[model samples]
Target chain A: MGVIHVTDRQGQRHTLECVEGWRVMEIIRDWGLPIEGVCGGACECATCHVFIAKDWVEKLDPATDEEEDQLDTVITHPTSRLSCQIIWTPDLDGLELTLAPANG
Target chain B: MTDNIETDVVIIGAGPVGLFAVFELGLLDIKCHLIDILPKVGGQCAELYPEKPIYDIPGFPMVTGQGLVDNLLAQIEPFHPTFHFNEMVESVEPIGTPEAPLFRVRTAEDGTTFTCKAIIIAAGGGSFQPKKPPMENIEAYEGTGVFYAVRHMQMFRDKRVLIVGGGDSALDWTVNLQPIVKRLTLLHRRDAFRAAPHTVEKMRALVAGGDMDLHLGQVTHLKGKAPVLEGVEIKKDDGSIVSVDCDVVLPFFGLTMKLGPIANWGLNLHENLIPVDTEKFETNVPGVFAIGDINTYPGKLKLILSGFHEGALAAQKVHRYVYPDKKLLFQYTTSSTSLQKKLGVTA
Candidate 1:
């Protein structure tokens, strides 16, 4: 089990508790956060974008080539990541991220 | 609820690629009928992001998704392809032998079936249905008070409506129905929302002015008798429950796209996508073709442009099985007078 801290575009914070191996996007979406997993975690649409906090950016798995390509279509921040690509584990227990502004 | 259709080609989806397929098939003097699960044509382009601008479509500098769909519909107007909206292609089978096969396509919604010489599966990401909330007795109040969508606004007028979720649908309806409804409550687990920021701002303004209520909690239990809804029990962040009077409950939980009845059809699938030869976009079954996003190839890119190219190539091959006796003569739309006439364009 892990808890993710998500700060929405409106600057409101939500601490979501999720099980291990759950996608951060799924946790945010289930709790009715601002994330729109339009392609349903397919990595085809970048609607589920989030900016990992500076400290936690290096903890998660690196983005894949397909994810990198899809991310190219969106405006990227230095710590930009697709929430769907980030899987929760014990290492990410207190991961902090902020929702990215939609490029759409 | 209508007579069975007999056509030269039956396109399974009414998306842009499927609409374009109608044009391609029409150029070869083939008649087509399209079926889609959406109530209208244009699939994801119109449904998901109609207002979203698409920059890569050929010939258009910048066309919104809906704009591209509109042009495609007009381009295929001369063909007069029949479209059956709100119907899904439930089953597809080869009627004849493998050498010379015909297809029989049926839809689950109604007994409407089609007999065709060739079948084109252009179902982009398959059917898009709203994901129902996972509450236990949610199904019991499905039609009585629970609704995934609002077909009409008047139904909620003068009623205590509780709108759940934070997506575009929920926010849009909350704002739209607040003015007419007797009491409106926009309930979510948090203050954060997924809708357009401007729309959210408007909703917040309304809440601040006390026009509607904004409660931060997740619905835990539904309170009502069978076929009549009364209220909902919400579990707050502090583990406290609050009951809100609600005559109607609209849960915009989101959508789930499945292959749907297409999976039952005997076709080779790779990760739920139809495996088709790149040459003709033909599936393992003869006379049956899969195109658009529903199909997968080694280098398949699920883009509208890629689907358009696949549709053109698939049409050429479909011509062989649809009219085996006629020799196909490929011609550009710019130079072919026959194709121009077919498009109702005369020099």
Candidate 2:
């Protein structure tokens, strides 16, 4: 199990807990945070874009090719990552990230 | 029965983008009637990914695709947008001239018609058609013994039914029809299912209880006469052919999106998407606005939030065509009393 802190676009923090093998997007969405994940978890729509907290960026699994391709079309930053690409693991507990701007 | 209706604007495709279009157009005092091939609203969000969370809708940080659709529906409820469900908009004809035009939209399933001042093509990637399994005689048996979609559950009562596919539809029908059908069998290439985990677990319980049979194989052949399917031949993983006796075959291979009747609407198309100007999102044809994923423009993004923006901009332009004499002054929802009154939040 792991705990994740998600900072939404409104600067509100949502803390959620989940067992391993859950997608970070699923965790945030289940908690009723702001993420559209329009293509579900297909890594197609970039609505699940999230900015990883600097400290936890290196600890998560690297994004796959498809996830990177989808991120290329959206606004990106140094810590940007698609939440669907990050599956939860106990080793990476205490993960923190911020939801990105949708289409502002 | 033929029903003739008149509206200020007729929005096609009742997805998130189309639902939001009603709100934007409603703000301009323009009434709308929405049509979708799906039986219900919330196209992809409701159909493909109802449970998936969407991160990028401006105000709320995260809402499920279906949740956003629900909120959009509630937001547009005050406007009272009319909805025509389970009907495909088959033809769009310019009854009036190029400059001051009126549109006559006709549906395929029922001969219902809508005459409108403007048309908003909010169809996301157009109509959805189910992908059929690779069986040579499948088409011949369609509507007789083989079916793609179940329109009526009573038609399947007490019959030996064979359902193919591993998606939500297959599992859903398996659970729903278990009590009605005389015997039911679910066949897939593997034991894995793409349905909800709880649903998958429930189906497994039913299978273990001998309530239904779960087979692992592909339907390689259909055994039936012309227009009358009798059974199917399955090729098991071990390379042996097993024949399952059944009166009906329902293949739920999922759906494919296509640019159906809108392709013949005389609008200029860039590839498969309707090309539109970024300002008003008007198609090459005047008085016809194409928003959502069905439209393409410079720096066009297919996200639902982007479509909402396009709907807002297009509504501004639609106001001109809908009410040419009135001058449209933009009003913010936060301060405009008239807007708040329309939203029923004026207290």
Q: Over the stretch B217-265, how does candidate 1's per-residue lDDT look in tens digits? A: 6777788895688999887756687999999999876555667888888
Model 2, DockQ value? 0.03
The second chain of candidate 1 has a TM-score of: 0.82
TM-score of chain A considered alone, across all candidate predictions: 0.95, 0.94
- Candidates in order, TM-scores: namely 0.70, 0.72
* Clash statistics: count for each candidate: 0, 12
Per-residue lDDT of model 2, residues B1-347, tens digit only:
68899999999999999999999999999999999988899998887678878888898888998898899999899999999998899999999876777989999998799999999999896787775655766789888888888989999999999998777888899999888999999987665677799999999999999999998777778997878778988887677889999999988866656688888888899878999999999988899999989888888888888899999999998898889899999899999999999999997
Clashing pairs in 1: none
Write one digit per residue (lDDT tens) for candidate 1, span A6-102. 9998999889898888888998999988676767786756779899999998888998866765554343455779999988888899999999864
**Candidate 2 Cα RMSD (Å):** 12.2
Poorly placed runs, candidate 1 (over 4 Å):
A1-104, B134-145, B150-161, B166-184, B189-214, B220-231, B235-240, B245-248
Candidate 2 chain A has its poorest 10 consecutive residues by lDDT at: A68-77
The digit string of per-residue lDDT tens for model 2 on A3-93 reads 9888887898878987689888998888888787755678766678899999988897787765665554343556779988888888768
Deviation from native of the Cα of residue B30 in model 1, angstroms: 1.0
